[model samples]
Target: MGLLSGVLGNASEIEPGKAQADFAQLLIQGERVEKAYQLIRDSFVFTDKRLILTDVQGMTGSKTEYHSIPYRAITHFSIETSGTFDLDAELKIFITGGTHIAKRFNKKLSIYELQTVLATYVLR
Candidate 1:
């Protein structure tokens, strides 16, 4: 990801293999990362079984929180593509119990591909 994009709070797509390795301890047997996105200090990892959100906290970045949301718990989702003036794409995911998560991706990442990945698991 470009430094400017990170400074602007826009996320970038990351290698799935790297995410898979970094999160191997949290995965159940047979679960694998299919896609991953990186922010400045956090990351979102999509796996065959669930979505993993890594939140790096504190000034020292020593504390971290991992949140997992299963595909079956995702009630619905929406994707907004980048427009002529709007340079960022956005994704909103609604969970089973009124939880909402929104993420913005820079123009460099394909929002359609992210939607496809979610649909493959959520719609199954």
Candidate 2:
């Protein structure tokens, strides 16, 4: 991701291997990370079994919170592709019990590919 995008607070893809390693302890026995995106210090990870969101807190960044949502809990999702004027793509995921998660991806990330990934799990 470009510095401009980062400055704008848009997310960019994090390497799968790195994400896997960083969130290893949070994964269950058979779960594996499929993809991950990072916005500043925090990350939202896509795993085979669920979605995991990480929020880094405190000035030292020691405090952290993790939210795990199973694919079965996802009610629906939507992806908005980047336009000529809108350089960022948007993704919105609605879960059971009225929870919503939204993220914006910079031009470096392919939102269609993200849609496919979500479809693979959520549609199953």
Candidate 3:
């Protein structure tokens, strides 16, 4: 349960003014980030124009992949609150062209905030 425990404890909510410089560097010139969440080495950033998903891979964290999903392409998203039986809350994004992205957060994280943030952006 060592690895499982570590994975379950990795939901780090990124607060304003505490975001990493590298994450901010991923932003475009006029883009602005409203919310961010860090999971171990990976992270998700919600910007004014789109959502930035960063995947950091490799043994030494040398590789990085950025996924930019425009707010217009986000058709809908769903949030599953964690329960006593299931200790993980999940947020799923459904984009255009039938693409789906899911991120799981620790039970302590506020998934509803994420939902509201996306709704404000995507429904605009």
**Residue-by-residue lDDT tens digits, candidate 3, 3-101:** 453377545677745554556677778667778888777878887788888888999999999898899998889999999899889888998999898
After superposition, the stretches of candidate 1 with alpha carbons farther than 4 Å from their true spots are none
Best by TM-score: 1
Estimate the TM-score of every prediction: 0.97, 0.95, 0.85
Cα RMSDs, all models: 0.7, 1.0, 2.8
Best by lDDT: 1
Residue 56, model 2, lDDT: 95
Shift of residue 113 alpha carbon in model 1, Å: 0.5
- Each candidate: how many clashes? 0, 0, 0
Q: How accurate is candidate 2 locally (lDDT)?
A: 0.91
For residues 1-124, could you state the per-residue lDDT of candidate 1 as single tens digits?
A: 8889988889988898888888889999999999999899999999999999999999999999999999999999999999999999999999998999999999878999999999999999
Q: How does model 3 score by TM-score?
A: 0.85
Candidate 1, overall lDDT? 0.94
Candidate 1 to truth, TM = 0.97
lDDT of each model, Cα atoms only?
0.94, 0.91, 0.80
